[model samples]
Target chain A: MSRLLIVDDDRVGVSALAALLEDDGYQVVALTSSAGGLEALSAGGFDAVITDLEMPGLHGLELVRAIRECSPTLPILIVTGYTNSPAAATAVAYGARRVFPKPVPYEDLLAELGAALPH
Target chain B: MPADDLERVYRWGWLPLIGGCVAVTAAMLAASELLFIHYGFADPTRLQRVLHLVRGAVMSFALALFAGWYMLRLRQRVEAARESLRAQQAAFARRAWKTEQAVGLGALCRLLVHEISDPINGLSLHCRLLERAAGRMEPTDAEPVRRIAAQLRDDTERLQGLAASYVEGNRAPGSSERYQDLSLEEIVRAAVAAHPCPEGVEIVVEAASDLAPVHAEPDRLRQLVEYLLRNAIDPPAGSHRVRVSMTNDGNRVLLAVADDGAGFEDPASVFRPFYPASSLRASLGLAIVRDVAREHGGDTRAANREGGGALLSVRLPMGERTS
Candidate 1:
């Protein structure tokens, strides 16, 4: 099973999304803070990371950069409610594999994640 | 001179001057005729008669000069009036252009907010959660749970409707595009069908039996009606019901939506494009409705309803049927 890290300030949102992914057969580790996500990623083996754009201690782009520096090959996906924010585009430029605006269909996210990392 | 007297003198003094000149010339002619009669005929003192004729000739010249001056004054007055009218038209055009720019900017802001903030995201996520939770329940217990999930889906669609309106508003209205001959009653029905009334809010629709077809962009009209209904039903005002009605005379059609919401906190600023806070979403919605109505040779107005809530009305001229 592919292990994935989910980072978002909204605890309920992160937990809900984690549950959705886990049901689809991936081992999901959910964090409500980006700082914790970085520490967890440093500690070890994760197939991919799904993060939100807006959060405290580190913004989405900064988190993407921090992740990229640590593991250049790790697939990063940004799932944000702010679809129109330039930061989503910036996150993509900084090597995140995909940006999914909130209210995005679960099937679409599933398909994108599958394509990003081999099942 | 008093200001009024000066104005009267300036306007009518030339008329009297011309009239007096004509009278003086006529009097001189009559005096000349008398002089001719007074002069002896046999050895006629023709020189005296000649002198009277000269005086009458001079009076005629003076009368012609005064008449020419009066015509010049009249022409100048007419030119001044024309200039004033042109200035007024220019000012009116400038004001219109400014209003258009303000509206365009407001639309842009509204588009940004609608696109950037997915109000439906949380709701949609909750719907999925409800579905999952329902799946674990007994079949009998799952029925109501599924129904609630369906209602959440309906609310999501309502949010999507708002997003669609933003896109529609961004598109320039074509002289011939997206317009159809639609019944007022049918449009109201469709809008109400899509509306998801909040927990305690009730939505009621009343339409005239014999309603005329309105020639308009279907999306634009839908946006207007849906926005009004959503506004009435969603906001956490004290009211619990919204009443929507349609009525028309032979020449014009009218649609009114009344909400028993907190009645506008500041009724005066309700329809304005931008209000005090980022809560301008409601204001922007109403502004779009008003713009669409005006585009169709109609107008919108708002008022505080008696007892509670607020009333909004949109009036559109009866359009010719293309079908």
Candidate 2:
């Protein structure tokens, strides 16, 4: 089973996406706080990390950079409401393997995650 | 090289020529005075010598003055040529800058079209599917199809708005009077309707029910709204929501669109023409909005929100409606 971490500030948004991803057969860990999420990522071993672009403390791009430094091969996905936004390109530049716009189709996210994760 | 050497020699030759004329004239006058005194035909008084000396001096002075005037005229012509060359260089620089901006703007427009094309094409395909299904199904069965068609239409309009704003960067030139009393709420809603918000993104509008109307060109207002909404929408994909609010403060009405997405690195540079932002869509969108606002005697400003993301506010004066 692929273990995925989901980070977002909105509770409802996180819950809905988590449910959708769960149904797609991925073991998910969702976090709203950036500090706690960073701590968890440092300690816990996650197959893939998917995070929101904008958050209170540590931004999604910062998280991606941190993840890249700690685990260079880890597949990181940046999830944002703004698709095709300049920030999307920035997130990708920061070390995100893939960036998906908000309201990402469950199947699309699943396929992206599947492709990004190492066997 | 021989011709240039000859020209240089000719240029220096004038000084000697003028000096020779002065010397010859002086000798001739001296000779004339000596002959006048020897023959006793004229007085060799101090006044007579002074008068002869003054006449030679005046003639020499006149010749030198004429040559100096001619040299100054030559210098003026050379200076004029240099001035024109400088002007041409400045004009070329301006043209190059404009060309660069146009190319950048064109790329941005192409990207906007590409981004919205998927949703618009999807909407069109869905509509076609609904139409074919409607022809083969009963009225009750077709109800769901109708709903889907409506949603597609809404999404299509949103895409169209995005495409329109993208292309509107190159609108025809016109004077400032070409304005009308426009409803801010309606324009904002139209812009929002035209952009299919990403699946997890929510666009919320907050406007006073009794907000005063503003005098503006309808198309320009729509463009402004499109720009603002585009900026608000382009953030990292997640459960982020964009809020667009409108409020009236007696003299002016304010329209603010803010996003809980990736905020700006430098909020002050947002209004500058061709200032590269986080997104190409954002750079072009803000440029368009700034143009539209200035056209209507208003201004647009962007600032980072305290918590997160960025806020863009456009304030337009509420002119009195003419019946």
Candidate 3:
């Protein structure tokens, strides 16, 4: 099983996505803060990082940049409500693998994880 | 060009005025000579005296004609200059009014986007969670809950689409509607370079180095690439890498953005304005992308890649006009 880290400032959203992903059969660790996400990321063992673009501290793009420095090939997916902004593109340039807008489809998320965490 | 036209009018005005005066002077001198010949039959002394009076009258008439011609020429020049000034002032006023309207509209859009974005995002997030919970329930119980969640999601997305339209439509009053020749490769490369890319996500550009340029609005095209790239690599879509390429067919240039990520379940719904199931529906990003393409007399389409993932392409007509 592949290990994935999910981060979002919205507690409800983080938990819900975690539950959904867990049901899809991945080893999921969900956190409501970027600080916690970063800590978990630094400890290693995560196959991929999934995060919300808009967050309280260490925003999505910033976290992606930080993660890029450590794991050059780790898959980073950004979930955002504001997909139209320049920040979306900036997130990708900073090393995010992809950006999924809010209310992501379950199957698509699964497929992306499958590709990213291919054992 | 207007100035040149006015200059031509001035030339025509002066040429006629000067020519008419010279003709009048010649006619007057001829008439004086005819009168002098007719008076030769009079007594010698009376005729001499008559000649003296005629000379004075002719001199006065000549002077008066010269003064009238000079005054009329001065008036004509003044009128032309005044008209030119008025035209310039009117143009300046129009420009100022357009600037004011654009600034006001820009402020309104910013304020509205700021106020409404957070609440809508929150609502959509919760609604998704509700739908997810509803899915795990008994079939009989889940149906209504799922229906309501779906309804709520639809409504929330409609509002989101409206907000996006407002932002896109809030163009400045005098924004350029003109198209210019643009290199697709340059724009795509720039946008890709600017976006933050995480590991395992590589953007492979497959454009021919000498591909033909497309006629397009540069800023809008840049936005289109940004939106497409974001959607292609978005984690839920499941592609770890993306390929952006360009080609030409007939009179248009085709820009294709493809991802090895999970492809769309329904390719046709991608461009619909408020369909939530489609990945591009969140902010109606795909709709706007399609609209932009259409505005340029072009078209956009989405399709499932044969192996996996998705392919989104836009066709922009070649611009023939030089800016």
Candidate 4:
């Protein structure tokens, strides 16, 4: 089973995204804080990581950078409601494989994630 | 002259008068010597008398000039002091204005974040619920369920984008891009759906069937609509009716939002930063609206509608610029 890690400041959003991913046959581990996410990563493994762009403690971009430093091959996707052209460009520049706007289309997200992960 | 004036003049004249008196006394002494020539004192020398007269004249003139110079210097000092005070007062006013703008902007940001958070939070909850349901459902049942979750996420992301744009426009180093081809009616409806008007207030939108699409940022366009709706809903007990109408004026698109509520005295001032006319405690909404319009290479204006209430109009260029 492909294990997925979801990080979001909003409990509801994390839970919702996790549910959808889980339904798609991925083992989902959802966390609401960057600290918890880092801890999870240190403890062991996740096939893919989905994170919200903006959060209170550690932002999505920083988390991605950190994950890349530890595991260069880890695929990180940023989900955000900040879908302006500039914001999107910034997210892409920050090492995010893909950026999905909030209330993202579930199928689209899943497809993108599937594509991002190595076979 | 009045007593005070006389005293000032006397104080100034005293030095000159004393010099004059000393001159007169010296002249008298020379004459006495001339008269006493037979009593062994040589006749006062012509050169001596001439020198004495010259000395007295020079001394009196110097006294008069010194006094005048002193008075002029005093006046200059007083003027300098006044100018310094005026400059300080101006500086203080400028600082106060800057501080006020900062506070107002901060409050506006807080309000905006608070408002935006609601939808984001809701979307988050829905996503979690959907996720939980997908966990227990069979593969066949979960497919459709998963699709709904994805759509919800997409919508929420759009909402976040709109909110972020609104906040970004209000900050420094604002975005420079002009308007683009976008659906004005759709953006307005989205804003309304994102933040529905108060329960009592009724919002009605009317647009020309063939209204040309406007060239503007979709997020900013939504912000303009939200601002108008917020203003319309902020009045005391009254028949709350907000009418939003759009028209294509050849090369430009005009959107008008009119409300039948407590009208404004000078609607022009509503666009001013921290405008105090409306009963709204914080006037950032109007400021934001005006900023968003200007950012899109457009303009926004507000006015008191005929009979009663206030009306706000936003104008933008339609289609691409040929030039």
Candidate 5:
């Protein structure tokens, strides 16, 4: 199974997403904060990361920037509440593979994730 | 619009007209007198010259008085025109202020809706998960559980659509390229079918034959039709029946929706967005209808029906529209 790291401040949302991903046969590591996410990524063997936009300590873009600097080729995807806002475009510019608006459309997310990592 | 400017015009505007008139009159009199005396038309006597001077002064005063009076009347007319223009300017300013307030509220609602939609989305996604989990189980009531999840998901989607309709209602009407040639009657029929009738309420939709198609934004138009139907079917006092009629009047499409419900206490207040929070839904529905009508180069009106219900009408240009 390919491993995935999902980060979000919304614990319920993160848990629900993690459950869904896990059911799809992915090894999911869920975090409710981005504070120690960088250190976690440094020791990571994850195939991809799925993150939410607004979070305490580090927002979506800042985390994307950090991750890009550390692992340039790691597939990064963002899910945000503000897709119409510049956050989505900016996330793509900062090396996020794509940004999905919440509540995450699971089918699309799954399709994108499937394309990002081999099953 | 300054009172002082009018005051100044009244005080000084006529000085040149009257003064010039008087001067020309006086000069003409003196020249005639000199010419007559030099040509021997009259004797060069002191009494004659004094009489001529007195006559000239009287004529000058008469002419100046007449000219000043006429100018004062003309000035009054100008003042009237200015006052009318000032009233129009004030009215326009008031409308602009209202529009600005609506726009500000729209921006706030847009952000608020996005914030709200996220949670609604989550709730909906949870429903999806519930359905998926039920799929793997062989429980006796599995179908019912799936049905409940499906309803919850559908309701959440409806809530999102309602919020979006309200947010769009608060927006300014301007150019938009997303429009299609659609039948007004067809849209009304679809709305009627989609919107559930309130308990004890029956809805009847009537359309004139051979109704022409209109260029419109179908989604917004459908929302408007649904909102109208919703309002008519459900009121505090309950409604027995509702009737929606559509017709083509020359180059425009006309829609009238009438409901036998608790009639509007204030028909004018129905469309205002800044009502008590309790009436926010009604306000939102009406505002959406109003703005959507305007965006399509149409208008909406509300009135208390003569036989006891409320009557609402919408008229739209049958020509092509950008939005």
Candidate 6:
């Protein structure tokens, strides 16, 4: 079972996504704070990181940058309300593997996570 | 260039006027001296002759001084007028910018809707996932759990409806237009014809002879072309000539309209869809152009040409104008 870290400022959004991902049989640790999300990733066992683009502090792009510096090979997927926005492109540039717009289709996110993971 | 011309004039253009003034003053003095000597008004004494010469010289000096003072005043007035004109232009630009923002309050509403849409959609998705999770719980499907699940489903539907209303209200242009292969040049010609250029406003259209057809809706494309034409030929910035061009680069059909006017304060500003006031209609038109072009599997390019003025163009893939 691949372990994943889900980070978003939306409390319910994070839990809801977490619950579904857990039900799908993946080990998940979800947080509504970027600070905690960073610390969790730094603890060193997660296979992937999913983060929101627009958050109060440490925007998704910065988060991706920080995570990438520590774990160069980890799969990082960015989810954003603002798709096609420059920030989304910047997040990718910062080493995020993919960007999914809000209300992201669950199947697509799963497929992306599966593909981005190490075989 | 205008400033350079003004500076050139200030440098040497006043020489002729000063020369003319000197000639007139000299002629007057000579005539007066001739009259004084010819009329024998002064006694034939050395002192009297000397005094008469001195008086003529004083009067001549005063005349030259007056001419110089008048010319100085004229130059000052011209400078003052030019300064005033510059101030008015600056004030007008500020006011126009404010007006563009005012007319674009519509864009603000659209932005708000977009912002609202994201959260609402996220909420709706969360609910759906929650609903799915709730259904799979074998022994956990108790009465309260079932009620909670039902409530989540209803709330999810409500949130989705709310989001749809906002999206439907603020839908981007040409969202519902039908598409088919159409000659872009034909649409350009019709749009140019529909909007007759004002007198003194010259409009020129250029198209490649073998331009390929683009997959686009004729009516919607016409509307987009008309907006571009109106924005170009009849801009509030004031232009004498506008150029409308259409061509194909093997894969995409490119269409553009350019005007010889004050280009965007920032070339990038032309494509930014939202900015505070000036040329309300022009901003609105360009916004539609951007939205429509994006719908057609392409995008807009707003730029200041190498020569001058702004060029707004949309490039649509010839084979696939829709994504």
Interface RMSD over true interface Cα atoms for each candidate? 12.2, 12.2, 9.6, 7.8, 10.7, 7.7
Model 6 pairs in collision: B96-B277, B96-B278, B97-B277, B97-B278, B98-B277, B100-B277, B100-B278, B101-B277
Q: Per-prediction count of colliding residue pairs?
A: 1, 19, 24, 25, 0, 8
Per-residue lDDT of candidate 2, residues B37-67 (tens digit) = 7989575788877887898788778777876
**Cα lDDT of model 5 by residue, B255-289, tens digit:** 89998887788887675453324555555677667
Model 4, B310: alpha-carbon shift in Å? 51
Off by over 4 Å in 4: A23-26, A42-45, A53-66, A69-71, A80-95, A101-108, A117-119, B1-73, B80-84, B103-162, B170-323
True contacts kept of each: 0.25, 0.00, 0.08, 0.13, 0.34, 0.23
- The worst-scoring run of ten residues by lDDT in candidate 5 chain A lies at A81-90
Model 3 Cα lDDT, one tens digit per residue, A30-58: 99888899999989999999987655445
Off by over 4 Å in 1: A1-3, A8-15, A22-46, A54-59, A80-90, B1-116, B161-165, B168-323
lDDT of 3: 0.72
Specify the CAPRI tier of model 4: incorrect
Question: Cα deviation of A58 in candidate 1 (Å)?
Answer: 5.5
Clashing pairs in 1: B237-B262
| DockQ of candidate 6, scored on C-alphas against the true complex (2 decimals) | 0.11
Error of 5 at A58 (Å): 3.4
**Candidate 1's residue-wise lDDT over A1-119, tens digit each?**
99999888777667777888887799999998888888898898899999876664455666898898988999998887544334555578789898886666778889989998985
Write down the TM-score for model 6.
0.44
Q: Give the best candidate by DockQ.
A: 5
Question: What's the CA error at residue B158 for candidate 1, in Å?
Answer: 4.8
Q: Alpha carbon lDDT of residue B315, candidate 3?
A: 76
Work out the TM-score per prediction: 0.46, 0.38, 0.43, 0.40, 0.54, 0.44
Highest-lDDT candidate: 5
Per-model lDDT: 0.72, 0.69, 0.72, 0.69, 0.75, 0.71
- Give the local distance difference test score of model 2: 0.69
